[model samples]
Target: MTLNNDYFKARLEELREELLAELAVAGPHPESGHGYSTHPADHGTDAFEQTAGIAVRRNAERLLYEVERALTRIEENRYGICRDCGQLIDRARLKVIPYARYCLDCANKHSKG
Candidate 1:
């Protein structure tokens, strides 16, 4: 069955917006040693905060990349085709994961690999 391009395009737009919002929430990491000093306690807290912020930003960046990839697929007219098996991805699965690159069988095999 041919996939509905409009529906997937709408979903991709929504996901792009959501991921951008999340990245905004993560925000840019503050400069290291801005308020930190050589004092042990102060140094520890500053280090912890910096590490946490970096981690969150990294995750946000990854999500943003995935969202962008989905948008690219939409533009390429390849959005709903499974990359691994060259088959139409199930609509229900697309509803759940608009950026999915594999259909159920291929996805299952990939997970096992």
Candidate 2:
């Protein structure tokens, strides 16, 4: 079956924008810092907040990277094709993941490896 390039492109673009916004919101702010508070509880809270912010930013960055790659593949006329095996990816999978770079079989193989 032929791939619906336009639909996937739009979806990937939307996902890219969302990830960018998430990254921006999760980034460090001037007020989000551990001030000169000597209280142990306050220090722990500050540490936990910083750690959580870092994790959120990291996850957003990773997803953004994948979304960008998908966009690039679309531009190159390579969307919906498995990178590992060069086979056409399932349309159902594309509908669900819009940014998939491999077919289910190849993805599973890579995951096992």
Candidate 3:
């Protein structure tokens, strides 16, 4: 069965908003030194937090990139097609990962090679 564009679009929009909110809360600017701490223990805690914040930002950015690509595919009438194999992606997989670019087989093969 074909996946619904409206459903995927709504899901992508929700994800985009969630990522934006996360980035906002995480202080979006790591190089500004906005949350420095002076105490030794506090410094360690601050360092850990900074590292975690950078990871969170990177994850959000990656997901945002995929979501944008999916949205573009929706607009271009190319949603649900595997980028590598030019085949229809499974509806179940799409439901689980709306921004997926490759089908399961191709994804596995590409990952292994």
Candidate 4:
């Protein structure tokens, strides 16, 4: 069955908005020293937090990139087609992850490497 275009658009848009909000609050900009701890003793804690925060930001950015790519695919009339296998993606999978670029089989194969 064909997936619902309206639902795909809305779901992706919602996710994009959420990721943007999360990025805005993503912890300290160490370069700018905006959220870093001032005390020397707290440097260790701050470093850990900074590392974790950078990871969080990177993950959110990756997700946001995928979401945007999906949106672009939709506009190009290529959404729901697996990038590797060129198969139509499962409707249920699309419902759960609107930004998915691979079908289950292709995704599984890719993940194995």
Maximum-lDDT candidate? 3
What tens-digit string does per-residue lDDT give for candidate 4 at 1-113?
A: 44587789889999999998877766446445565444344445465676776777889999999999999999999999999989999989999889999999989999998
After superposing candidate 3, which stretches have Cα over 4 Å from the reference? 35-45
lDDT of 2 by residue, 1-113 (tens): 45499988999999988988876655445245633244334343566666776777788888888899999999999899999899999999998999898999999999999
CA lDDT, every model vs. true structure: 0.74, 0.80, 0.84, 0.83
Candidate 2 wrongly placed segments (more than 4 Å): 1-3, 28-46
Instruction: Supply the TM-score for candidate 3.
Output: 0.85
- Report the lDDT tens digits of candidate 1 across residue range 19-112: 6776565443344444334333534355677677567667767867876887798888888889988999999998888788899999999999
Span of ten consecutive residues with least summed lDDT in model 2: 35-44
Can you give the TM-score per candidate against the true fold?
0.72, 0.78, 0.85, 0.80
In terms of lDDT, which candidate is stronger, 1 or 3? Answer: 3
The list of candidate 1 runs beyond 4 A from truth reads 1-3, 30-56
Ranking by TM-score: 3, 4, 2, 1
CA displacement after TM-score superposition, residue 101 of candidate 4 (Å): 0.6
TM-score of 4: 0.80
Which numbered prediction scores highest in TM-score against the true structure?
A: 3
User: Could you give candidate 3's per-residue lDDT for residues 22-98 as a string of tens digits?
Assistant: 77766646656763443234344466787887888889989999999999999999999999999999989999999
Q: Backbone clashes per model, in order?
A: 0, 0, 0, 0
